[model samples]
Target: MKIFLTGLGFVGSKLVTHLIQSPENQLRVVSRSPSATLPAGVHFEQVDSLEKVINWPTLIGDSQVVIHTAARVHVMNDSCDDPLEEYRKVNVRGTLALAEAAAAVGVKRFVFVSSIKVNGEETFPETPYKADDVPAPRDPYGISKLEAEQALQALSSSSGMEVVIVRPVLVYGPRVRANFYNMMNWLFKGVPLPLGAINNKRSLVSIYNLVDFIGVCAKHPRAANQTFLISDGQDLSTTELLQKMGRALGVSVRLLPVPVSMLKLTASIVGKSGISQRLCGFLQVDIEKNRRLLDWVPVCSVEEGLARTAQDFLTGRRA
Candidate 1:
């Protein structure tokens, strides 16, 4: 199977590593930099911009599957005047352009690595989000992803190109960064956090599990034209997650049982409502579709995944 991959970021690089382990997969990666350290026997192409017009037919030639992992991710301290348009330029326009080119070149399947935010920012305690839920993107990043999914679906409908969309929750693993990594760092340092009272449930996926699922989707016959909501198949509260992280790091966490309502009020007063919401919000996904339809299960357990990540962080493998 000839596979063309985009974005050599954390997820893309890991996916490349996993795919190259199989001799049957002929991998080609596109990066903006010429100095990317790709595995042996894999081909590389350099492209300055995904939104710019390029020779797509040649780029996607002989590739049976195109896995798009490149996107304009969420910007916390955005400086742009119109963040949505900025995001659209890369995530929406660039993604659709690549898909169009891949379809034009007769790619067998297009696997789009989407975000769970497309379903919504948060879910209710009793009601988990299903794959078939109507999209209600609240943020610019989520809106862009939803638009890209819609565009890909339209393209797949118009053309005969099979499309598989995987909306994954917070992906954490060896090279993990952002809020999850920060939480791990806080746990490693035994920082007392005001999240003991946060009983909100959040679903997360390990990078290993996500890459495994992508590999399955790449070749699974039943995955064609399907949208999947993937997770670790386990929901955890903020306190539980921090405690697990502490255990992974071989340390004990100190959690302060601050009132959830007081925390929200203080966060709102300090203009940190977003952070508070993420720390005290419910965001669970129902991954039954992936399990039942494709008979897929997570390759790494949450504990194992967290341990690996903590070990990597401790050893300075991911700093």
Candidate 2:
């Protein structure tokens, strides 16, 4: 039951905390962040960088499953000279190298944490992105993830290494970074947010549930060579989402009911269109395949997930 895990970010760290609780699981984690804390008894290995090649064959030895969560994360309003090339270096090529070496060293399964953006960034109301929908990545980061999934599938076929791809939407939990964390801070500090009138629906997965699904995908025989779209199975509008966060944080929302069209216009003028799109976009995912094929259900409800995150934020348990 030896498992090799890469990336010690919010998602990977949570996965470790969950997996190490099982006595039957032997954990080996590899990451460039040597400063990351791990539970006692988990073996750790350091690597130089994701984009750089290492002796992965030696590093992944005797592990039955590998969960890869490392990559160059998506940057909003990217100013890079060549964002696609930069993302492909780490997300695509780096992943292929790791999977190839894992296969060489007899790793049985590779679980890839992908993004819902691979099915395009938006969906019409009541029409969620399906598990088998054609990939239509709108940005460089999404494109890179899609490419990595393709490469992994080919390697899985030729090398007999099982590959499971899980595409999750807007994962939220303790120690979340980037915009989600920023939104939480605003809610905590009682900032006047202009998202009250946004009528867009978004599907979100809790970190606890996502890690649980990853564990299931790692071991489930039916998960081999399949892609899963997962969420809390509850979709919420932007206004409702902020309201819930406000309640969780024990604060009243100073949410301004601004017009969505005006907000988008202002964002366009200021070159922050991405933020506006996220605030007023419709992105829902259908997790029917996750239930039908894997018989999996989310481990926690959204209310519980938000409550845990709120507790951590108030107490400074994780950052």
Error in Å for residue 209 of model 2:
0.6
* Residue pairs with backbone overlap in model 2: none
- Best candidate (score: TM-score): 1
Taking all chains together, each candidate's TM-score versus the true structure is 0.97, 0.96
Summarize candidate 1's per-residue lDDT along 184-266 as a digit string, tens digits.
88887778888898888999999999999999999999999999999999899998998888988989899999999999999
Q: In model 2, which regions exceed 4 Å deviation? A: 317-319
| lDDT for each residue of candidate 2 in 148-223, tens digit (9 for 90 to 100) | 9999999999999999999989999988777778888999888898887888999999999999999999998999
Any idea what lDDT model 2 has? 0.91
